[model samples]
Target: MAQVRNKQVLLKNYVTGFPKESDMEIVEGSITLKVPEGSSDVVLLKNLYLSCDPYMRILMYKDTPLSLGFQYSPGSPLTAFGVSKVVESGDPKYKKDDLVWGVTKWEEYSLVPSAKILFKIDHTDVPLSYYTGILGMPGMTAYGGFFELGCPKKGEKVFVSAASGAVGQLVGQFAKLTGCYVVGSAGSQEKNKLGFDEAFNYKEESNLDAALKRYFPEGIDIYFENVGGKTLDAVLLNMRSHGRIPVCGMISQYNLSQPEGVTNLANLIYKEIKMQGFIVSQFYPLYPKFLEFILPHIREGKIAYVEDIVEGLEGGPAALVSLFSGQNLGKKIVAIAPE
Candidate 1:
């Protein structure tokens, strides 16, 4: 078998504080075209697209439990959700040329255990990169967190923090589809044009609590928690009675050594607010139903998704680091292959 040059983004060490592009190094590695003989339950992949998600930051910390037992070591390729084509497979459920999206290393090619694969890509009508964003994990996160946990009703007022992000954007749209009034908070106004009932730039707001009040005079019935810290503290004050808050990623607090404390727990009792944190994997069972609901809206132009894509494997480190600086305009993705 011929060996091919595999360009990889290697984690330099367990990260602390904010991550910088210098924390990762791009290096040339080599891999055989075929999976090692007799390696059962392994699949060789030609990685196409790699997703840059905020959850990945948690995985960079030493022995971070957020990784769910997957640990990163110095000089090892960083792991992320990606789209790939199967080059060889030892698993019965997959075969040569199968398209799949799931956990993959940040490299041109990867040999991964089959269990890490979330699902095989069956729908090709949309861009294959969609598997890394709107049609994949982020999509499912929004669906399960909002519809399942949020339990929002028609006419309810909903607020989404980091509303222009991959999952938050979808959550806001889903709220609108449910006949709810939705307002989103983003870092910039240019990135805030995602079909929400109203959107605000959190950076421009002198008081986030007042911003929420301006958007939801009646008070927020649902708050899709994305950015935590002060944003969450503000949302807590504006929550309506019987409100539901599905805690998603808290990007603002992810890199902090000391996470900010929320000061309004008493409001949860007084307002009877239901605030619950969720992991996307817990709701994988609802994926099929979510796809059925979202696909049509996508094809008909009823749904909109934004992606901030960087080209080539060499660009992975800077692209990943850009997330912390809010440099990427939308869902951050790296296109490793032409597809």
Candidate 2:
């Protein structure tokens, strides 16, 4: 046969509140191995590693798009940031067997437009799976949010919520690299995993404001906001005068039928804090710069990245659903095919 079997995880229905494993189904389909005769710049890809991020939850809802920029339709295979190897390419820029990472579907094989792929994977010294987490989008999110938005200064106190996450882990590391004092918070189950100077369990803290006060006696100079709601409210009360808060993800509120209200917004004014919400696309122009800044650190062992990888396409849905429960110890990844 000139075709290959494509195994896919399709969204069975639009998610209402919290997602479940039953929300997605694995479907088997067939695809031509070659890019069609006259197609230009269409790349046939063998998907390898899929990055399971919290933003994907937003897309699972009927109304909107996440970073990949498209709403998820019922019965359609979901799209995500992933690592792939080109099986065939009708484009000059990519040849057979080129390793690349960017937007790809949650399937064993994918046919993607060349533009969907951000760029060819140039460095092979690191595990290709790293492209799904540390060396790719999540890493960029932390770099742009913390260094560019949070604007850490030497000796400043920094705090990151959901710190063991794909982006937050890197954010704490970046804060430490800038000579700042770093503290992180995770769910009670994951607080013991080390990546920050100090760590606490948010689930165990009765008063988040008191928790922040205990960690940052003076005040936090930079707060890398990940799980919003109560965390943002508490951080607001503890922010230093003229402090910066880079709004990354609101994971705590994403699956809520009614999003939680953050009552301490007035604290932003009281403390003269700068709270800015940003998406990763705004930082793509600086990707090359981010690579130069981060690659050396990664190679020197100055940075550490942890990933909780689930092997096989069948496990994709559960792996993605794990984010809301804080089940993943670090970056959640779904491995489809071996590189």
Candidate 3:
């Protein structure tokens, strides 16, 4: 088989503070369309869409276990969740023309281990790009974190930080669906228009603690923790007795050299708060149940998902960098190959 040009987004070096587009470089490489001979349990893919997530920033830092023991390295293609089509398969579970979503490199084509492929795309009725956002990891994160860890009840009051992003938006909607009163915090009022019962611009608020008190005079029953730091500190002060806080991502602290400390954690003991940090992978067992619950809502338009899509692999670096700056209006995605 002939080798095809593979354009990739490579980490230029370890990042510090904030990531700039210059931190990553676009380079042209070559790959054969075929899986290597005698290679079992590996599949060749034609990558279509790439997900740009805040967690990817953590992996860019050198000597960090966030990359899972150097899974990513400088001068190598950045890894991310992506939607792809199988070109050739050395695994029985997949075959030619199979559609899948899972961990893949930021390039037009990839040769990845079959184990990394999370699931075959069974529901093509929806947009394939949805796998990069609403129907993929972020969706699962919101589902597992909110339903499993938060364990909210009807008529409960829920507050979500960074509620405009992929996971936060879904968490707010899920809370509402469960008959909870939902409030969301976003950088701008426009971004917070995702059907939450109430929305606040945290940037405009002089005091987040006062802001939360205003939103929930009765106190929050469940706090979906997305942006940590000051927002978390404020939420800590307002949690009702036995309130659950499902800590997902601490986007506010990801880039900081020294993360801000929450001085109000003593409130946890005083209020009997149940605060737990979680990674989405821990709840993969619930995925089948999650799909059954969410897919119908999606098909019927009972749920809404927003995405900010940039075209081509060349735009990957800027799209990834924009996540930290709030430049993208919604879930950031790169369309390497549109279907």
Candidate 4:
């Protein structure tokens, strides 16, 4: 194949609050499908779907460190996890037409430096797009954090805040599969219908603490904490003794210039609770184990997933900005091109 031109979404500048469409620009650039001469471990890929994660919104700040994830450098394209088809490879491990999932540039095409963290999509029987989300990062997060950290037991009562988001939805379903009673909180009533045994519209609730109490009259045994702050405080007051709280994300705190104060800390001591915060990257070694556990369930139709897909790179900026407003219904993804 010959080298070809590619379209890319470039970061126009650092951002604050919700990002605007003007913060990014789509431009065309050229790259060889063939690896450049002397390159030994590079893989060129055509991006199929780019994940629009909430974390990307935090990276729009120029001061956000590379350790958090790459900062979207000015004049350069943003990056994210995505599913792609390899068009060219300079590494012996990869070949043309291979389907893979890993970090990819937010553009029509990406040249991966090395396929180290990338994995091949062995289960083509499932949707290849699933690799971009439910079967990928979010899946791993739910499996590791909920099962491993939350340590849920059958019949235990579980609560998930931001329950309709990517990780929370899967966590709720996983709990149901374990015979646990599960309740979830979402911003709207429509999302409440998907999987939760009891779903409440957080926005409609007059008092968050009262709402949680109403759902878990016997108290919650485990909490998959996605939205922190007031939700966390409310959950704290309602936890059963020795209950587990796996702190996966605090999407509620991401946009605030300063974090909202929580007056309660004595509950952690009084209840003898186990509340731990974690980043999914810390659970990488368990990836293979997670795949082993989830693949069968997914294949058997025991698990379900939903996605909010935007048609092209042009919609990426607005779609990402919508995360703060709870505008996305499920896992948000950008279909850069056709499958």
Per-candidate clashes come to 0, 0, 0, 0
For residues 248-316, write the lDDT of model 4, one tens digit per residue.
888888777787887777888988999888877777678788788888988898888888888988898
TM-scores for all candidates: the values are 0.98, 0.97, 0.98, 0.95
Alpha-carbon shift of residue 247 in model 3 (angstroms): 0.6
Clash count for candidate 3 is 0
Alpha carbon lDDT of residue 135, candidate 1? Answer: 92
User: What's model 4's lDDT at 104?
Assistant: 88
lDDT of 2 by residue, 1-339 (tens): 487789999999999889999999999998889898888879999999999999989998777745455668998899889999999999889999999999999998899989899868998998889998888999889999998899888999999989888998898898888999999998857555455789988888999899889999999999998999889988988999999999999999998888889898888888899999999888878888888998898899989998899999999998998888865578899998878
Tens digit per residue, CA lDDT, model 1, 14-57: 89999988899999999989978898899999999999999989
How do the residues 163-269 of candidate 3 rate in per-residue lDDT, one tens digit apiece? 88989999999999999999998875575468899988887899998999999999999999988999999999999999999999888898999999999999899
User: Candidate 4 — which residues are off by over 4 angstroms?
Assistant: 1-3, 65-69, 115-117
